[model samples]
Target: MTPRSSLAATAAALLILTPTPAQAAPAYPDPQPVTGQQIIHDPTVIRLRTGGYVAYSTGGVIGARLSRDRVHWKDSGNAFAEPPAWWYEYNDTGDPWAPDLSHRDGRYWLYYAVSSWGTNHSAIGVATSPSGLPGTWTDHGKVLTSETTDHWNAIDPAVIRADGRLWMTFGSYWTGIRMVELDASTGKAVQDATVHHLATRPDLPYAVEGPYIVRHGRYYYLFASYDACCSGVDSTYKIRVGRSTSVKGPYADSTGTPMLEGGGDLLLEGHGRFVGTGGQSVFKDRGEDWLAYHYYDAEDDGTPKLGLNRLSWKADGWPVVR
Candidate 1:
């Protein structure tokens, strides 16, 4: 054999006999810089089947943007030209926040939040579209809601397929994050489905939100934002993650602390002018994982702007934004 082939064969044989060393999670990389109409909050991104990508964010009628490449973006307009009438029942302004996008059976499912700030009375609504373009969605009204008496606030919805079922997770502040099985046919919560309490922090600020779960290999990773947000530069938001073998966890961080008791591995934090990097959603584009979120731009007067980073998992199974 040639020297290169002999070296490769020997390495392969060694790998077969030697146990792989644990991989240390890499440090979070600087956010990929993108410009043009970047103001957005609670962004979720998806690649269009035709070409390019679209990101839906919180604002009047659910603001959206389009990008030919993932880096440079332009405003595509809002999902709804006019706010859905039913949304006014939950909030007078009828604006939406934290839209989650999922694809199934050649259609797109969009779940968003409707509520007045600081109130437990909130609603999570779903909209459907054959083409995930601006103004193509049909409102499906509220899939779940919360009242003053309810322990959980229904918002920031994310849907994933796990255990051969569709599940939607939503919540914020009041009682942390929650999940329930969804009816794949109707894109609604399955009737009589038990709501599963996933993660929480009962401490004073009670700040946990933006739950996004994805099943990778044998483990389900739950990603969430913790601490305060929405105050621009003063925002303290950071992204954290936990993993469990089952969808309904007892998820824990690398240190084996339960997520329900404030156990989470820190995945991303503010650096320099990027303050409060949180409200993240993970998507695979062209076979590589990417994280989409909003961060306060300290140099730009703390304007909330869209941030993107490549996500990589260690050999030990911990995710890191690199």
Candidate 2:
């Protein structure tokens, strides 16, 4: 071969061997369109047997909103006419945060967290309502609590039943997500229940919080919010997920990275008008799974608003927000 042709062949070989940079992951989809009474935070939504949908969120003594078509919502009122006296023990203002709503035993169970900002002295309280409507809840008091000395912060309670046993997962920035067994009859923690650590960051000031677990097929998927929240447009909150074969997980992400070691698959994040998408929960409505969360609206002065998205599953049983 000619000397010039030999050099050209060597250059072509080097080009084929050099690796190209990986493409960025696709942008997350926006929440489905919702209208009216959209302002909310850390929202937990459920369908009532009587019909329509009721959403309870963190504000105004557990604020309530009702929707007849799931597209439009109207302010209902606070879940309680007055704050339970016990709430004052944790916070002077008697303010409550993230709440989880569910139906069991022919009644509605409401679990909520009360705490002051930047402290671990928090408690998760439970209330029951026959009608699951505003102004009808009967406070049953604190289910569990955490002190400043404890490794885990008690907040963001989410419950799931697996293998005929009730389990409650709750935690915050202290150490990350932790779970404890709950007595089905009382909706409270079982005596000396095991506190299982689910996920956390390996670095200082672990920022993971707002955990919700759902049993899909043969695995339990743990969804959690990562990074700072409650800062309106400046919040860095996003959602991540991991799954385990057992309810009390050694949960790991899609790449087989364990959640305990700062591993989580990025499920969703801020995009355009929807900023700081976090504080998420999942529930089924009419046989279709839905993701209920809160996001700060960039177009509306950074007001936090309710966000709803349909959840579709892949063939591998992993969830995708549609």
Candidate 3:
């Protein structure tokens, strides 16, 4: 062959041998098997001090589910018998979404969002329950709110206590993930708190939401759902994560890509019968960290269902969902 032709042939061979991005994508694992009352969305689960696990999600006035073994769930009821009168300010039906459940100061705090579809006029509300069970919660009213004029959407709240202060990470679509300080005593936003930006898409519609922060070892990790959700099998939702040394972050992924610039390491995504895995939270059980989220089950006609996975850390301290 001519030398010029040989060089062209080598270039073509290299192109043939190099894997495309899709071909090089990692094979993701399916969620551990869960049975009974698996249908859910934006699930936040925690093991109670009194024993067993309780989960709150988006539906039916903060829908509730109970699980004994963490593998079998049963629908219990709504956290509240009826919506608070103030919730009607955001939505006509008074619907709530994506609750964060945690135990602090001998009480259970539930933080959730209320808003209509496709609008930034939203509020994050707080409530307290002695047992973290359905029907026992007392609504404390709005903790934070966003008007249509605001750049950030006030939704998908996840709170963590760091440096002896309470902080909540929340946002969606409008400008991605954001954080603000909370009054520890009241579980409400600190008066005139600074809203810190965390993550976003480089493009329009942004598409990142459901921010959850967990402190693992020396780093504070930020986990957020990316792309669209709620379209059943057509949903493109996936979970991604980044880490920073400080809870109020300039977080970056494993490759040093800043989350503020739309960078995150993929932690979980759809595979096989599981589709659109996102809306995630992290909690510890028996000293082992586990991820709790909802996935659209393709085998079940794209019904959103409970998904749990144990998280194992790399030697470098990054989380890997097992």
> Which candidate should be chosen as best, given TM-score against the real structure?
2
Ten contiguous residues with the weakest lDDT in model 1: 24-33
RMSD of 2: 2.1
Tens digits of per-residue lDDT for model 1, 1-322: 9999999999999999999889975556788888777889999999989889999999869999999988899998899999989889888888798999878888999999999899978999999999898899999888988899988889999999986788998889887999999899888888887989999995855699999998887999999999999999999999999999999898999999998999899999888899999999999898888999999999999999999999988999888888
Clashes counted in candidate 3 amount to 0
Lowest lDDT 10-residue stretch of candidate 2: 24-33
CA displacement after TM-score superposition, residue 115 of candidate 3 (Å): 0.3
TM-scores of the candidates are 0.91, 0.95, 0.93
Clashing pairs for model 2 are none
Q: Would you list the rank order by lDDT, best first?
A: 3, 2, 1
lDDT accuracy of residue 293 in candidate 2 = 96
Between candidates 1 and 2, name the one with more favorable TM-score: 2
**Best-first order by TM-score:** 2, 3, 1
Candidate 3 least-lDDT 10 residues: 21-30
| Per-model tally of clashing residue pairs | 0, 0, 0
Q: Estimate, for each residue in 207-240, the C-alpha lDDT of model 3 and write its tens digit.
A: 9999999998999999999999999999999999
